[model samples]
Target: MTEANLTYVNGEPTLRFERRLRHPPAKVWRAVTDPAELKHWFPAAVETELRPGAPMRFVFPEEAVVDGAWDGEVLEVDEPKVFMFRWHQDVLRIEVIPDGDGCTLVFSQTIGGGRAGFLAAGRTAAGWDSCLDQLAARLDGTTVPARTDWVTPMAHYIEKFGLGDGTVTATTDGYELRFARDLVWRKPADTWPVLTRSLETGHVTKEEPPRVLEYEWSQGGTVRWEFVSDPKLGERVELTHTLPATLAELRPLALATWHHRLELFFAAATGGVDESWSEDRVAELVKHYA
Candidate 1:
């Protein structure tokens, strides 16, 4: 596999990449173009007609399935050889060339924006890298590793919010994060209060989502919430928070606090206790949340 070449066309964004795989045309073609086959790697629902002028959609997870999707039209189709489609309102081409047993897959995307768009174009390029790796692993029938590179983003968030030294308790509602430091509470919409902040000395730094925030006080680093799932539980509701760290470090105090948050959210939301988060039942919840 080779890195994608990214460029801008008249201030537009574009990305391109190439990969060689050890499979025949049919195998390689299905791997890249099939929705069921893609799920084994990317873990998302894919919808497309595999024909010209048809719409394609890739949705992220919410309820063990896709919640939102990107809708685009297919412009060209040369089946098992080459195909082009419209993504982000731009053109994307994918080509497969047969080798001895496998084939070479070449992918490219073109966007009509500027520098900002070109920078953003790199995101899809990286995403392709991840997705292709998963595809390879799937072809080999191997388990894909969970991506857990959250340390940098966590540290960045801590510094930006000016968050003070405070103990974090794992709560079920989310994370019962209370800043015990002495600081003045500024007006509403303060990034510090909403994200992370220090109540003492008014030292606060805010880190945006999908961005890293770090804390050096503990070598173990700070807790981070990744994905959130809102599930229906009869009259109540269960908010599942996927923290970056594992269950071992969050045990004892932290675990209890997290449970409390879940309880609070459910009780307040529907005026009742949600038994799904009970210790005996948490294993199941963790499985889904993980």
Candidate 2:
């Protein structure tokens, strides 16, 4: 399988991957369509007839990977050639083309025009890539060990997709931060759970929908978070922590903590490994601010 490709279609995002299977298209089609074979590789358990316009339901096998079910409709079915369906918020299309003795399978998912999903394309594509790897192993009558590390590949996709570009700068007032934060699949309206997951729920000074929020920090000063949608980067978070100029001497400590918090929030949001906080890590980052 090749690296997943990313592209935008009329302001929507799409992720595509291609795999060269040594098996015939018929065999591959079964792996994609048959419930038994699908259980080996598909991310969710599929429940639907193989026909266009049929309602489709997908229930995840593992609640840890994902909980609950998603509903969609089968869009098209061309025997041994094509299978297309609406997958919740995205459209999933799979195509198998005849290639000498084997087959070339093209799988693509078109993301809906939403801010949350597209922003985490890296994580989503990496997840699908892992599933495709399993599909290849299943077709070959072999098994693949489950991947334990999602952060490394996700970082690659994040950079490749030009995301997670958040920065912190010291200012006359205090500190300013601009970083890409994953809202998971939610807008800022449902961000309280994420915000209070690691940090305490300070007094909410201001609360706004889909855009702005502010709160009084327990550590003194005020914290504000803003959501901005960019045409290229999709959606991002901008934070401002207001402090007095007398606190300038502690810029390194404050900025380092906030900087690491950015990545920590991102990892948790994207379902990746979270590094434990340490003084050494903060000290290393402090050099940048100094």
Candidate 3:
């Protein structure tokens, strides 16, 4: 997938995606603006004429995670070159540039402000990522499945932006640690204080003994722990950490730190020492995740 970069346009957060397609500008333009061609790849069913100030309605597929329709106006329409539109409150602009026998597509969206804007950044980025993937497939004359699984990609974008749902699992290690839940209810009474003290650095957000425990970190984000009885592992634990949207640069460090902490937590919970929990080990794990 093509990586999307985050930037600010006019004081609003923006996501920019670029792609070099093997198709010509006219063909790419038709694929983007022609409703008939759009249905094969575009997420929503658009209804409107391609002209400036034209009203448009986007009807989402029934299976979409975000259901319902949104109304907007065509902000600009420089045929075969630029197509800009407003969807809800966000502005989407697509610019196509001719390059030899191919063309380059530059897509950008202006995100809103506040927490909602941060959250939308990931969702919108992932959604467009999938749509563009489909578009590429369409241009290549290959079949690409419709987007049905958004959670995985959304999680990716969330982590990419330094905010996470906060669960890290090492399938090879047969262990997972999550910060949002508690290990106290299922573990031995002797381990309760250790677990509680380890989590004391963060403010408790929710607690429901042996089931759910949530806390907000002093630096940023929230952690939630959940316990479930797996048939294979008996009582299992899962942790989720949610970080704020503004800390994109800290994602790598945050992931490494969390991995180290979880290793410590695992050792403490099991009453066994993890000698492998070292700077080198953490670096290796971080590189593996990266």
Candidate 4:
């Protein structure tokens, strides 16, 4: 299995994967194009005619399901050469080319999660990696891996694709941020401990169990945290900070500092090492979010 390459097609991020199969082009074509063969390795139960303008429905097995999916029209089919289709908001393309006596399977997908989806490139890539591995196993007549290790490949993709950085927006009232960190693996019953531990002191303005927590900041304004449910993790955090007019000039600093603090808190919760903070690191992040 080759490492995925991130490319852009019409300003959309595309994850491309290449696999060299020992089988010939005609043999590989059946595995990729035939529905019966695809059932062994393909992500979902693909149902559609082998022609363009045909309806496509990606039915997932209930127990091993992931997220929003299961419908599209077949885009193209060049018979034993190219197979392309739409899977929800994504455009997936599969190409089979002869290489010596064997063949090459080229798979690429155009991601479609909006801003959040852009940040989830690694997750998407890791998933396809697992699928391709299964395809290889089936072709080789070997037992497919029952469980794919997502964490190891995801970490590589995040760093390689620069998906760990969060985004900051300047609103009329103040600043809003959406983090791109992979904080989905571990979700605590009560996230308040992580919050209180991160910020230390703040008057509680709103509290709603393990879901929402609003705060009246000691420095002024409001800081709210929301724990959204995630499939892999119990929940993921979303933060909104409203700064007082007086703190307008300090918005960047506050956000940058919180970025570091949040990292510390996440590390603590996940039993990861507490790395020492650096002004240089904060300054660099502020430049991006400023």
Best candidate per TM-score, number? 4
Residue 84 lDDT in model 2?
93
Tens-digit lDDT track of model 2 for 1-290 = 59999876666788989999999999999999887788898888888889999888778654423435546889999998999999777899999999999999999999874755666787778889999999999989898999987877877787687665445576877665444555444445545455555665489988776577788766667778777654323455666777666666766666676667766766665454455777786787688668
Model 4: ten consecutive residues of lowest lDDT: 62-71
For residues 169-262, what per-residue lDDT tens digits would candidate 1 score against the true structure? 5655334333211111121132223223321112113334423233321322244322121121111111122333444444334444444433
In candidate 3, position 184 carries an lDDT of 22
Each candidate structure's TM-score, on Cα atoms with residue i matched to residue i, is 0.49, 0.67, 0.58, 0.74
| Residue-wise C-alpha lDDT for candidate 3, range 138-236, written one tens digit per residue | 999997777665555654665576443344444442323343222222343444454566665577878876566788867677767665542211233
> Model 3 residue 163 lDDT?
44
lDDT of 2: 0.74
Worst 10 residues of 3 by lDDT: 177-186
lDDT order of candidates, top first: 2, 4, 3, 1
Residue 68, model 1: lDDT of 53
The C-alpha stretches of model 2 lying farther than 4 A from their native spots are 64-70, 166-180, 183-222, 225-261, 268-290
- Candidates in descending TM-score order: 4, 2, 3, 1
Query: Pairing residues by index, what is the TM-score of model 3?
Result: 0.58
Q: Give per-residue CA lDDT, model 4, range 91-153, as digits (tens).
A: 899999999989889999998756555656776788788889988888889986576345556
Cα deviation at 164, candidate 4, in Å, is 2.5
Candidate number with the higher lDDT (3 or 4):
4
